[model samples]
Target: MFAKVIVDISHESIDKCFTYRVPTDFSLSVGDPVLIPFGRGKKKGYVIGIEELADFPEEKIKDILSPLEKEFSVEKQLLDLAIWMAEEYGTTLNQCLKTVLPVKKKTKNRTKPGKIQYGNPYPAPKLNAEQEEVLFAMQEYFQEEKVPSALLFGVTGSGKTELYLRLIEDCLSKGKEVIYLIPEISLSHQSRMRVEGRFPGQVAV
Candidate 1:
């Protein structure tokens, strides 16, 4: 059997898959981590596919060295998402996988115990006619099976923040997570404070 492996090399040139021979007695599956020969050195790779035919010359095809920890293998759903990210962003698959398998950072301080305010809904703000129209249009996007994203554009002091808070409250009511992005660092602190005050323990800077 031939195994299509995506080697864990963070280079765009070698991001594509290479076929390797699977030993007769050896077992392999998608998302399994394996050691493979690349150049003179060996590197870890993810098994993305398996096939019966050998694309490369039979003599040139190499066998997988061994499987990495079976328990720690990457999940298939995550592997598919990584593949999608690589294609969509024009980046190496290994680079996407790096994000998928990011290193866990140790927290310097223990988190303070607090009540989760996730499902709690915030009070709705009164909106002008223009703001109400835009908000209702955006809300319809969320009501559909496939919610398409929207970009909100308004001049300064045009009640954009209020609209954002109202949408956040709507999402919170539906048990959905919200990500609010502030373009400027100067605005981040103020917006974060407002969100924290409104959402309490649920807000994360």
Candidate 2:
């Protein structure tokens, strides 16, 4: 039995869905990356879905190449979120998906791992009384039942970065993922460098 599979197209194109025929022996699933012919060339994209169709002629569609990705790249919850974003932002689902996915970076140094490395080998400073109180508060908030958002408002040079690092460390120790946001590109770069230095090969900016 043949199935229709939808894939994303490259080149910042809005018309990203291209349907291909799933082979009889192939057991394909959503989120798998496949290479398929597009116009005169070929491109890589994730399999958005598969549908069984009874009426369409099978000879009209093309076959899918070997999938590049082992698992579904897009989670279902994230897909729902993307759909919501598309409706709210007046954009297509393909555009929203492109925005969420990481950009593919070409590299000559294939041996290097694609992760941030933190090499800060110096000792950390001792926490003051106020710093300790804030750290405790953060821990307490994390332990609560409700999802919480925090605003760290303080004057410049008030050790905000230090507090953030400690909070990140706490999250990591509890096997949680953390996303840090910065308002300025310069500050983002600085924070990325600091995280890379302290947690080499485990971070991504």
TM-score versus the correct structure, for each prediction:
0.60, 0.68
lDDT of 1 by residue, 58-108 (tens): 898999988887434667877888899899989999888776663444434
Per TM-score, the best of the predicted structures is 2
Off by over 4 Å in 2: 1-16, 25-27, 52-60, 69-123
Tell me the TM-score of model 2.
0.68
Which ranges of candidate 1 are over 4 A from the true structure? 70-72, 102-140, 152-205
**Alpha-carbon local distance difference test for all models:** 0.80, 0.66
Pick out the ten consecutive residues of candidate 2 with the lowest summed lDDT: 2-11
In order, what is each prediction's RMSD in angstroms?
6.2, 5.2
